[model samples]
Target: MIGSKRWCGVAVFLVLLMAGTHVGIGAESLFRHFVKAKGDCLVDGDQPLRFVSFNIPNLLLIEDDMEFVRTNPWRLPVEYEIEDALRAVVQAGGTVARTYTISVAREDDDPGTPKHVLAPGRFNEEAFRAMDLVLAVANRVGVRLLVPLVDNWKWMGGRPQYAAFRGKSPDDFWTDPQLREDFKKTIAFVLNRVNTVTGVRYRDDKAILAWELGNELQQCPREWAEEMASYIKQLDPNHLVAGGVQTHELHDWELESRVIDLVSTHHYEGDPMRMAANIRAAAERARGKKPYYIGEFGFVSAGGIRYVLDRVVRTPNIAGALIWSLRFHNRDGGFYWHSEPAGNRLYRAYHWPGFESGDAYAERAVLGFLRSAAFAIRGLAPPPVEKPDPPHLLPIPDVGHISWRGSVGAYAYVVERAESPQGPWQVVGRWVDDAAVSYASLFSDESAQIGRKYFYRVRALNEAGISAPSNIEGPVTVAELSFVDEFADLQRVFQMGGQVSLGALGARAFKEDLHRLEMSEGAWVRYWVPGEIREVEIRAFGQTDSLSLELAVSADGQEYGPVPVVQRGFRMNGRDYPYRVPVLVSGRIDRPGCHFLQLKAAGALQLGRVEIRYE
Candidate 1:
């Protein structure tokens, strides 16, 4: 009888353990609160919730042939990738992530690739399972998600695919009754389906902070957005609903709608004051009826980011801001989106852990600002806001002197000097004044040797701490100009034609530490040559047999003629990773006094530093 009792006890214990595992008991223990919208702010239980989030469009979709996905099919190992991305967000002091499109199209038709939506009304169990892992991992990692249900663009098999599936135009999908019904069915199918990995229905899942109707639905009528938002709310009242509209599309009635929980807007403006003014106007229009979120905002300048973020945190009605994106180092051994569109070309990808090589924006300063703003929005102590704008270094001709713009609100400024653009910089001067709002900061390194290159950067300092180092300016050499474009700052100098972009250097070069100009076939870079020229040396990196390029010298920017080129290949440590084979192309400009020098890629190649040996 005692032996029988022991067997029964063991069975009971096993049953309980199985039940706990199914419900994600371990993950549930970590996050005990569910996020809810209360007035204009999101709250977790009794505590008001404020978050700085990032967008990761392809979090759930995995490349089927990846080694991790192939080996761990049962466990849905792609969650590990999601975990890496989420951990980066949390580490950068971000609390939420706004994913791109969660809805995959029925017509994707790629057999080898994983499809989220296999067919109309029929979902891919494997893709759904991947989503299940995303939520499960999100809960475990303590990051909230704002999931977009569909896409405004065709890249993800969005509305266009939906319309195509039904033999209708993309616009008809919004107004046609049958298409609307079909969309509702898809929504019902997703929300009601039981998560295979989590053992919980998505409607019941608390990990999702909100449901975005669709991404940037500017073409869709406002009424359709309202209808879709309402339909989602009817299906699942647990989560908030956001109309993912651009700033221009937002209306007062939309914010006041009973179904719409938040109003989201995107901004890609360069002007900080204009960006802030738009936000303030949106907040006023919201009128505390619904929270306003800057769903997407990115700039090619650190000052621009700081300006937007500073405004966002100070505004009481604004819920939070999520930057345009964050990219992870996936199992594929590189970051995603190699073929990004031209408009999004300038936005840099922030890597996990170190978050280095971010374009234009300073990673450390941006993260620091975000962390502080997150606290401030939550009614916690304010973060230090003393980081100053980067000083612009302008070299004076014929003198070994440089002048810089003074920083606002800086108690002092520290100037540092380095031999190369990538620095082991030593402090050259310090300008200090307790009463001064700004300093007339200038330095003359008369003791420096002539003909040697010198790099200079500056930082603002106060009692709280020092700001991020300013832009690295110089290689101020006394040598006669051959050609010099470090490709360090391309915002104002370089002009691109055809299909070329500024990208992080895959291979390291001399003066410019991080960036390179990537050129596809027929693409070119036009540089205005200030003087009469002779020979030009181009440093480029690409596949040995694959890369072909030509140098053209033109008196007018419009027309050009190719110069004779000599190509050589060598090995070097790549900036994107390490150990890359690159090619160096050299040529003579037989014609002098050319106004423009155009570097045209005969094939796909990356142009690093361009130096012209001129007369």
Candidate 2:
């Protein structure tokens, strides 16, 4: 019934299409025209659309990149994250952003990982709804989307998953008759999807610029590309189609194919000379044929990136260039971070407006360049950065742990604390970035006396000015803890043995630390402390099953066994454990540890961080 109303609105828009423009009616009102492909340029009415943007890989779906909070590693992005991402693009002056392809579920995905397509011809409603929000917010924020239909890599469950559905080889996905038809079902579903919020079908959503066939497709044949592109055109004539093949070389068939309207390639050359040459070669080839752009590129110095971007601007027929990728703030606190292992482990996902903490990558300078280049590509001057709005402070569980949903473009924030809800307030922290920490508490107020009550609010800051105070969150009680290990350093580990490692199967490069709790009776890590164990707490990822995890303590480092366990929610000091990735356990255990405790897993699990209150 809800979908019926949405379609009826779409029908009304069609009837009034040639009449005039309308606003505040539905999502279609947000975008009055579709981008058109006209001989090497993409146009919205008369003006061509070019962008110096970045791919928002996790915008529609997420591979939870925070190592400290790593769990199933595959979770759906929340509303806060989706909005912040589109806002980041606007802050960078980018008009278009790309997202990772829809994920297909596979048999061996680590226990809790999520996939969009659970079975052939079936979809995960939760995941698709997350996608609906992406389109809705994109329209509301005035940013355009370039969505890929699927992926070639198994990292996010791609070709292999589809082929597996039919009990065939992964390569069969391209040739298998049943598999080809199965994939078309997905294509038709996406193009016809009605935005639950905007009531606009994806095929008609002006927020979307074009639909790419898949993400950097590998081993794809020209015949397959032509067939799929033709199929997509049949389903949605309102949007242009881009060939997502990962290489610089475009096949003659792709360039001449009537249905394939756009051509793109990914680049990662670190040398300026080679990168420039590569861009020229591709642009020259696509010239006079189809609209061409650099779909993805990065992994160089800031200056190197600028040089490549300059090459893109100067090279004829190259419409735009989207840098490697961008990530946004986490709802619970801080930002979701991902390290690019392919970049020799140097680059991580970028945040907007850049912060000092990101100086290592020259994030500030690079983003500054992107903002100017975004307008420069369109032959316009860059505008001044806007003032930041007040950030929304999350409910504080204790003074030791405070976090907030940061304002867009806010590189820092000023945290103010007060004795009463309405009394004199004092600055507790300044120049604080919600992204300084990943998936952890944003700030810790060490000055607050234990057992004292306080109130707190935070204001966002950028060049313009500090924003007004955010909503007050407090009467927060102060708490303390003696020992906590986030698993970043291994020096604290007294003993270790088993199938566990620092990272997991498909997510090793995410952050450099995170202890994967694999299923093994012998898998364990032992730590030594200097006091008797009184109360215990565990922050973990994955379900609590009979074999999930158990804590064992020993007076001597040689012996270990389970202690009486009492599970609790929230932190012992009244701090709330971040529940975004689902903190798995918190328990009170009795032990005579001359201070040594061991964590063991009898089944697959993920341990975020452990807090032990001891004397």
Candidate 3:
């Protein structure tokens, strides 16, 4: 129930981080044995670590900030987020979890940018401290971590970032002598870096399963991998080093390399037959040479995944497998969401226990298969899943604006209301997926009597059943003034014109979330509120930095002109980005009856949410 407690004030960030620090320290006494790579297996003692887990790519720093008009979605997660991620790993019955690439600074980055490696031979203290908590929490939970050193992609600032810093081509990351030595300095910094939370050096931490060179470094030459693997061994003899290339076939030199203890590949081949062939081929290559595993897979059909996992569970040389990715519970509310334009563009990040939005990717069935196969790989039957913990209902001033911190692994939520603090409760709303509203209030009580005082509570639910009721939030009274549309549904009271359409669920482009409306060139959405219009505020995201939106209001839907509105921006990820532009429709001599506020983008913009204050 302590999880339901809330923290407030300007010191909240520091408070949550310090809280995370202590919680991580508590795990120091838990699983501390580093996994070693024996021939064709990774073992803690004599038993190899086999798992059908997931790739929690954002376990350290989250990039999916999709909150309403949030300018930047990049920031370190709080303790609760870490706990939920690792707990999901445990609930899935897995021992080892792999993280995404470690971020590095680039030429374009300023001093304010948050990255693990600031520059060659220079490391960020705060970034590493954030990582220390990640490792600490991993140690506290019964999970081992596989940390990737850097990336080949620009998304996280890796190969090209280093090249830009050194004034060379991106390919120089593999062959150029100066850049190789520079990268070694970065590696040494990480290996020698001590965890501030647990007082354990990176090289000595048992929570780490292996140190991978980089993520999907397919461009890495064979000789460079050998040299770096050996270099890692010299710096950190306590852990194993794995090749981070993205391939279906493991080359002979990789199997024969003396320093490379483990060989792996990422399989996203959607064809079942081809995936099976790749699995068998990779297993044969590492049969008696090195420990082999599926570093990442899935986003394929459920039946296709069944075929692939079946082969993996049966293969002796294939030690384990991890699926593509999952997003955990956010401390503020709901789950953090990410769209993988990479994964058939239909599957976004899967919330644990699954929901209606994930039906397209068979999220429930695939997760069920993962659970059963995870245990089956270890020769055990799947166990029962536990009901979720109580949710944390955030306090609200009005019945129209209601939200709560979601319970991890809970598929849905039910909202209950009572006239008094402790009386008979009434079910106000059922089957609420916090992510379904996507940055909107989780539930709105349109049925609340105007002057009636009310109390609200919520409970999380999934296949295991309903969880205990959340903390009560109360004394909510609807006043005589206000009509707020958080934009959970656009078709309810708005009319669309020109090139405007509801950005459907699973659309990953431009940080698009559920219920968001996308307006292309010359498109407009007219908002009709049945009241005397006093003020209107629109929160939106522009596709381009230069494009602007035109806001106009009319007594009817026809006449329009440039309206007086104030534009605003907020600080995010160390830079100023455009934020909620509160368009103050000033005047008490307002339009009687209904007021129509129409918004149109000259080029393009995505509508996040809207608010209409009227008398």
TM-score of each: 0.59, 0.78, 0.84
Error of 2 at 419 (Å): 2.1
Q: Residue 381, candidate 1: how far off, in angstroms? A: 5.6
Candidate 3 structure quality by residue, lDDT tens digits, 1-615: 112111111122232223333343544435536788777876666455666788998887787765644545667777778878987877776667888877987655544557777778888788778888888888776678888888998776899888888889999889999899989998998899888888889899888889988888887788999999999999999999988886878887778888888878988787878888988988987887889989988768889988898999888678889888989877767778776766766777777877776787888888888878877776666567668888899987677678898876788899999999896999988997786756556777766766688999999997899999999998787663455654556655577789867665444443445556678878987777666576666666553333367777787677764566665543234322223221222223244554777777877677666767655
lDDT of each: 0.62, 0.74, 0.74
Clashing pairs in 2: none
Error of 2 at 227 (Å): 1.2
- Per-residue C-alpha lDDT of model 1 across residues 1-615, encoded as one tens digit per residue: 345434533432332233222234235623456677778876767555666667776676632221211221111237546666765665455667887675555453443445566566767777777788788877766678888888777765678877887799989978999878878888898789787766878888877888888888777677888898888888897888887666533676677677788887787666777777777788778756887788887663667777778788777678788876665533332333221232344444444322334423465466566656655554444323434444444553422334554343344667788888787888866763211210111344543554677787777665557778877777677543444554546753457788977766322221122457778999977777566567777667666623578788888777788888887765432322233345667787777567677887878877666766543
Give the winner by TM-score: 1 or 3: 3
TM-score of model number 1 = 0.59
Overall local distance difference test of candidate 2: 0.74
Find the number of clashing residue pairs for candidate 2.
0
**107 in model 3: Cα distance from truth in Å?**
2.5
- Sort every candidate by TM-score, greatest first: 3, 2, 1
Candidate 2 accuracy as TM-score: 0.78
Q: After superposition, how far is residue 586 of candidate 1 from its true place, in Å?
A: 23
Q: In candidate 3, where is summed lDDT lowest over 10 consecutive residues?
A: 1-10
